[model samples]
Target: MKLKNNHIATFLLSFLLTFLCAIPSIAQTPNSTYTIEQGDWLSKISKKAYDSPHLYYRIIEGTNEKATSDASFLKINSANDIRIGQKIWIPGLPSPKNLTHVPKTDCEIRLWYNYQIVAVGVINEKWMQDGIDLETRAHKAYDLRHKARVNARFMMQDKEAVKTLQARDIKKYGNPDGPTFTYLLNKSMEGGQSQEVAYQTIIDSSSKTDTRYNADCQ
Candidate 1:
């Protein structure tokens, strides 16, 4: 029996995550075939062939059963694997011989990470508002969480106090960066500091906090 590769899981996870997040627009459309090449993500290929990247998931969903069962599935940069010269079914597309059309722009971005909250800047009640799309909002949320995590790591708080905050599961209150303000407050409280001291500490380090939260949530 041949051993299965770990990269397959990674690829499936990446693909599935994106698929679950967005509603595929080309689910019922026709398909075309193409040979794989270097540095080709599904989005890039879909964009090249369909004129839109949002339709990649439809292709994946169409071919997922085959890809899932194969041992050499979804390998990164492996020429003998799922790389160059591999014939792939491009779903929700037309015949390559008849494909001479450019896909229109549909300002969107896809994210493959996690998020706890959607930003206020990206969401509104309008049917087609000017704010960022859901995909871009997801990416921005991840970026915000990552930045918060980094900030939490380098925060100039007492080590023991910070540890105490972590031990208390403060991350549940906010993104992966830890609680925007509660993490520091927890640390300060652990260190026997008053609310005034905590507020002053934040004021002193205001340059580092996220400017979006500087004005407080309305």
Candidate 2:
């Protein structure tokens, strides 16, 4: 059957419009979603995906609007808010490149304690290769840790120093454990001493009144 010229023009025009409209949907990048595992937190997601915990807000911002305005805004504990196979949007996050993920190298780590510069350390290639970077906020934390350890040691050797730290701890962080740094150091040397675990023990012991001072009597 012979088609009218006007009808053929309309058909071709319609086809062109349809193809143009499909470009955006076709070009859209497929989003990858992560299930909330036990111990998962916004900070952890930000760290794993964006390499910075400060980017947690970005993840919140990237969620679908329907998810945002509802009860799931900050309800991180709810499984329905985040579950297996849920299509979450991870916006502006770069895809992994190569067999080994190479973290960005151009970053610096500096630490300040009580508004004074305490220590500064470079984020070396080794740390970056191991997926550790200045973005992790580890260098400043580790610097403070070293400073705390040195101060703790000085306090252990000198009675006056111990009193000074105790006073400072009470004024700033409140209540010092009776067993003190001298005892903690001894315990720390006995094989395993993960800094996090050790710090937790110190905090727990300091908070508890039942724990005796110098239980070892050394």
Candidate 3:
């Protein structure tokens, strides 16, 4: 029933309310428990904890299961739902992503959400962030895509940084198709951290289209 509380259809704006204050910092590393830090992501945590980033879903399972017993541990609805200052549990034993064992539609939604996060991660890197908000950034990203729906281009100040990442993905994944991009993203730390006030505090703005791309997700 806890999982149903997060279903998009029943989603409420109240979830957007700010937490009064950040909880006191929790222990890091000694035992698998971690306080989500800026730039911290499940995959990155997995890499440090399990030696493989691909096993991030294990954290999702571990954290969510922990939620059932401890209200302090919030359930991570999706890969992109983690917020700064929250507590996360890194499972000591291997286990599948329990959350992913859902209907086919949910699986696809998860994939789409993951893509949005990756796109946001790319933009947030060394691009233009002169104190602009997420909504504005989302709009700008949408504008770039709209301007050139095919082969859109917005030069970054640090071309080499993005270029380096791009080059690495090209060599590791070959070309840049959906499957290949997904594979590369899963191994990245770009979308692992958040600079916002709360988790998913605003509109989803990392897609090639509008930030709220409900195209196939709905």
Candidate 4:
């Protein structure tokens, strides 16, 4: 009889422990909301909220299902089509914190540019080899460029600066083709100018070239 009672006590104790352990998971729920503003898109919001732009689907699933019947405020056709002033329910997002801002110095910029040039060169060599179709090479090159830009953003800690650099490069050299980036990189290294100065020089030269081409076309 004592052994039977001991078995019952042990079973109750184990059940109590299991139930207690599961309480936290069961009690936790999604309780946060986000108000949309200008330039607010799911990808950008997810990137800001969750540190990954790929999780935009979570916002759609969490918010749209709970949307009011009128659908005037929370209706979303696509992640890209979110309207300003709409309220979005965001689940499982951590509280927002200020982003760490690293100082942007000339040497850091130059180092980033050097690393990007090398990375792009390797990608081009690997993808542009014989027997690779032009479409495949183009797709690979685009992916490489995106990865390099993301890496550069991390190193530079300034998205605007990276965008400016790429835009200027595109304006000067037409797309971000590997050879053009390599040439500018070599020139910057040899010239010993600050990145700001080198960038200005490239922009000025590109403007002049455009003017000459336009004149020639007339």
Candidate 5:
């Protein structure tokens, strides 16, 4: 009798452990679909589902496979090309709590924001030179620009500080040569005043020698 009781207890414990281990996988099943709506770009959808807009590539890869094939589908060429009313498959994503948000100062935020704008402008000019359609180029530009802004926002924890900097940028620059935030931040960082001043100074000095920014790629 004693031996039988011991055997039963061991069996129950093993079953309990196995069930507990299976819970997480069951919870993470990704057999879900999302219908695209107005202003619903792949990056935005990825951000909402996975906490980072950069992860849209995962959705494209997962859904483009034969497993999720359906008649009513929109081909996803780039993150910028999803149309309204299209249905997309949602892949299993890790928990949002696992993601990291890097903190940045107001000055750093402005600099990064401007850098992205200029980078997007450069890409846009290239696309024009390549003779890509206006609509496709516009979509790609919007996606790239939006991703840059979203990334800058993610790096900073202070929302109020960002707002203040944006307002200051608009009031001061009011349509400057580069993006408003970039120009203002560059000016602020000039003369080695801030920590980033050294890096910005190097970039500024090199601009005189490098014609990449001035090249008439278009």
Candidate 6:
């Protein structure tokens, strides 16, 4: 086991991210096959499949679940834990129709949504490259999260604000551990309210937090 220095760095960063898991909370549906070559990593494999590297955890979950029944997949414990020449499963879970797993009440949504903004804000910073101080990364994200404007924007989500969405029947995310923030931009033709819209609203609301986290949370 000789792993590149970058892989070790990825491991350290991954350890830090474990503080607040941004793992996709959606259910797992392992259906694709991606041959692992040298230099393959979970984030890279996830980017290839989902067009976003942040969702790598989904592949890890999907592959591991598939392995329990088939014994042909690798049980990944970290973002970079994969072997070359091993045929890893490319995870693809069914899209959620509503928030069955997510707390339905506005207050519950508030608690979960607020928690998600901070957790994701810290994760999506992607401040793991060499020469970047981990302390600085942590401090910056913390500071921006409490900034007056950021806090104000976060405060906007209330029971009254999301009244209509609460009435709609949101689909369950299947996986209890997956992240609730589905970055999907799909919309339904049913009318002014939709499952995708409702979930996206929660995700989009965190944009301000994410922007500052990424830009200033260095």
Best by lDDT: 5
**Per-candidate local distance difference test:** 0.43, 0.42, 0.51, 0.53, 0.54, 0.49
Residues 172-205 of candidate 4: C-alpha lDDT, one tens digit per residue:
7675422353455457657688765554333322
Error of 5 at 33 (Å): 0.5
Please say which candidate is ahead in TM-score: 3 or 6: 6
- In terms of TM-score, the best-performing candidate is 6
User: Which candidate model has the greater lDDT, 3 or 6?
Assistant: 3
Q: In angstroms, what RMSD does candidate 4 have relative to the true structure?
A: 20.3
In model 4, how large is the Cα lDDT of residue 135? 41
Model 3 global lDDT (CA atoms, 0 to 1): 0.51
Question: lDDT score of model 1?
Answer: 0.43
Q: How many Å off is the CA of 127 in candidate 4?
A: 10
Ranking by lDDT: 5, 4, 3, 6, 1, 2
Misplaced by over 4 Å in model 2 are 1-30, 64-87, 93-218
Check candidate 4 and list the clashing pairs.
Answer: none
- Summarize candidate 1's per-residue lDDT along 1-218 as a digit string, tens digits: 12356778778999999987575333322465555656666666756766654445445544543456664334232212355656566644222331233222110000111011122112222312656554343334444545644544444245675465566554465543345565655665688887766654433232122212211211
Query: How many clashes in each candidate?
Result: 3, 0, 0, 0, 0, 10
The model with the greater TM-score, 4 or 6, is: 6
Task: Show the lowest summed lDDT stretch of 10 residues, model 1.
Answer: 106-115
- Itemize residue pairs with steric clashes in candidate 5: none
Candidate 3, after superposition: displacement of residue 171 in Å?
A: 43
Superposition error at 92 for model 4 (Å): 2.1
| Runs of candidate 5 exceeding 4 Å displacement | 1-30, 66-68, 94-218
- TM-scores vs. true structure, each candidate: 0.26, 0.23, 0.32, 0.29, 0.30, 0.38
